[model samples]
Each structure stands twice: as C-alpha cells, then as structure tokens.
Target: MRPAAWLTWGALAFFMLNLAALVGAVLVNSFSTRWFGTWWPEGFTAAWYAEAWREYDLFDVLLVTLQVSLAVVVISVLIGVPTAYALARRNFPGKKLLSLLFLLPILMPPMTYGIPLATVLYKFHLAGSTAGVIVANLVPAVPFVVLTMTPFIEQIDTKIEAAARMCGARTSAVFLRVLAPLLVPGILAASILVLVRTVGMFELTFLTAGPDSQTLVVSLFYSVSAAGIRAQQTVDAMAVIYTASMLVLLVIALRFVNPTQLVTRLKDPAQ
Candidate 1:
C-alpha cells in the first residue's frame, strides 16, 4: 500500500484497539469480585449486576426512559410528517430560511442552546418533569424527522396523489390509503432513529430531568457520582446495562433502515 494509505490503516487499527480494550476492561470489571493492583480480579461474580439494578432503582429508570422516548417519538412524528409534506410540495417565500432555522438545533451543540431552553421550560414550570424532557428532546428531533422524511416525500411522484383525487378520494383518504403506505419505510426509519437519539440524549435530559423523571443515562450518571462511597463494580454493571440497551436499540434500528440511504437522503434531498 501507499505510505499515506498505510498510515491511515495503522491509525484506524490503533483507535479500534483502544476502544475494544476499554470496553473489554469495563465488561470484566463489572463481573469481577475484587481487583486491587492486580491484572485481573481475584474472583468472578454476577451479584454486582443484581445489586446495581436494585440500588439504582433501574427498573423505574428504564420505565421513565421508555415513557419519555415513546412520547418524543410520537410527538415529533406527528408534527414532522405534515410539516415535511408541506415543505416538500409547496413553494413559499422564506422556505429556505425556514429550513435553515430547522437545521440550527441539529447543527449546534446541545450545550450551546440547552441551558437557555431549560430556563424557558423552568420559567413555565415544566422543567424537572417528563413534559420538559420531551419538549427539550423535540427541539432537535422534529427537525431530524422533517429532514429525513422530506426526501422520501419528494421522491414520490405527485401524479399518484392527483390520480387518487380524480378517483373521488378525499385528502385524508388519499393520504391514508396512498401516501402512507409508500411513506411507511421512511416513517419507520425516522421514528427508530429518533427513539435511539432520545434514549441516548444526555445533555438535554440531564438539564431537565428530576429525581422521578430520570432516564437510564441520567441514572447511570448518578450511580457513579452520587454522594456516598459505592462499589465500583456496581457502577460498572450499570454502565454495561446502559451500553447493552443502546446496542439493542441500534441493532433493531439497523435491521429496518440502511444508514447509507438515510445519510444520502439527508445530504441530497433533491434526489
């Protein structure tokens, strides 16, 4: 291989090795019973997993995570689909500017705007609540759905809709019977992506979440740093659970959506 190509491969391999080693160490530590100045633990045990689950109140955390994630997905999709249809079909003044506005949340880091957004939510007495988390997550998610679905909507021929109208179909009937089926793949892809994003979202969730409204990510953070002297094994076990949950969601998402296609759709919406 060329010198530059060889260097690139070497760097990639080094990065992958470091990542794998870190993950492997965490996995082992989570299952180990004791390890102090040793290469490995003196004994192995599965009890830490159970201890972490109970002590962290992870069942409730997981429940809150699901509730918040599902709410965000439903609300983002409802607001996004019709908005995407309008943007795809209509030509209005300031359309490009409006689209740029939509892109702002996704383009900027959450920390940049999250504090101000959280302040607004708190001002309205919504912060530290489930509704606040959903609203905070939606700031980016709605735009994501719009961007992802617009290309799908545009790729579809409008002539089909015109024909449906000619057949005496009402607008709602045409949308439900004709457009929805064709849009299913796009909708499913967007919803799953949003679901994963919301579940893994840390900044916004951390800023808005309260004791009762904490998601798994927020709960995991607390497990590591909340006051008392806790077992490192327990914290590692929670980390493993969080990683496993995200991996499962991503796997399910990849089963239905091609990442390359999703990327292409976003980059070249005209296509």
Candidate 2:
C-alpha cells in the first residue's frame, strides 16, 4: 500500500477508536450499578436499564418524540417539495434573495432566531404547545428539506414534465404521478435528515414547549443537569435506548436511500 493511503487508513482507525471510546463511556455509565471512578464499576448490572424505563415512563417520551417528528416531516414535505421543484425548474426576479432567505435560518446560529420565534409563538398563544414546537422547528427543517431535495429535482429532465403536460396531465398530476415517484430517493434522504434534526432539536423545543410539550431531548437535558447522580445514570440508560433507535432508523432509511449518495460523494482523493 502507498504511504499516503496508509496514513489515511491510520487516521480513519484513530477516528473509529475515539468514537468507540465515547460510546463505551455511555454504555458503562448506563449499565453501571455504582461506577464511582474506582477503575470501572465493582460490578455491573441491568438495574439502570429497568430503573430508567420503569420509573420514568420511557415509552411516553418516545411517543411524544415520534409524534412531533412525524408532524414536522409531513408539514415540511408538503411545503418544501413544491418550492424545491420551483427552485430547480424555474428562474425569476429575486430568486437569489428568495433562496438565501430560505437558507438563512440554517446559516444563522439557533440562539439568534429562537428569541424572536419564541416571542411570536407566545403572542399567538402557541408557545409550549405541539403546534408551537412544530412551527418553530420548521424554521430550520423547511430549508434543509429544500436544500436536500433540490439537487435530486434538478437531476430530473424537464422533457419528462413537458411530455406529461402535453398528454393532458395537469401540473398537479404531473407532480403527483410523474415527478413524485422519481424523487423517492431524494425524499427518503430528506425525511431521514429532517427526522433526525427534529428528534434531536432542543433549543427550539426548550423555548417553545411546555411541561407536557417537552421533547425527549429536553427531558434528557433536564435529567442530566437538574436531576442528581442516580437520575443522571438513569438518563444515560434512556439515552442508550434512544441511540439504538436512531441507529435502527438510519439502517431502515439507508435500505431505501444509500447514505453514501445521500451524504457526500465518495471519491478517489489522489485523483
């Protein structure tokens, strides 16, 4: 093997090692009966796993997480798909500005936008409610949906749409029956990205959701910082479960849309 390739492989090995270390810490903490820094827990137990779920209503929190994530996915797709099609298919005045406007939220730090969004939701009596959280979360998600889907839409040929239109297909029909299925890979990729973002979003949820409206991420945050040590360990156990679920979702999503294509193109670096 070439020296450069060997170096690259070594770097990848180091990265995987660090990742393993971080994950190992989480697992140990989650399963540790009393890991008080005496060089590993004197004994490990499944007590934390049972305690976390049985005591804290883990399934309820997961329900909230799934509901919010699904809502965000549906609403974002409905709004974003058409806009992505327009952006990919047409040109108009202020197009650049309009595109930038959609992208600004993702570019700006969360704190910058959250304050104003909170105030708006409060005025509308939506704060701390599911609607409030969903809308606030949409600020970033819609832009991401557009960005991720636009490239796939662009990859499609305009001639196909033109033919459909000539064959007595309405614009909506062309979109529904013609362009929609073709964009499945893009939609799948976009859905997974947005769902992950929604599941992990805390800043917007913290500002917008109330006690019952709080997301799993917010619950985890409070569990870690506000609750004491046992609660912390229990939270780690819950996090372990959540991480496993995320991995499952990724695996399921990748089965439909290749993540390598969804993420970045793998290339020969030396080329």
The whole-model lDDT of each prediction reads: 0.92, 0.83
How many pairs collide in each candidate, listed in order?
0, 0
Question: Against the true structure, what is each candidate's TM-score?
Answer: 0.95, 0.88
Off by over 4 Å in 2: 1-8, 229-231, 263-271
* Cα displacement (Å) at residue 90, model 2: 1.3
Across residues 103-189, which tens digit of lDDT does each residue of candidate 1 receive? 888888999999999999999999999989989999999999999888789999999999999999998999999999999989999
Pull out the clashing pairs in model 1. Answer: none
Write candidate 2's Cα lDDT for 1-271 as tens digits: 9999999999999999999989998898888777775768777788888898876677777787888899999899989988999998889998888888887887788778999999989999999888888899998999888877777788899999999999999978998899988988788778888998888888998899887777788877777776765656788898898789878877877677776776553122112
Pairs of residues at least 3 apart in sequence or in different chains that clash in candidate 2: none
Misplaced by over 4 Å in model 1 are 1-4, 268-271
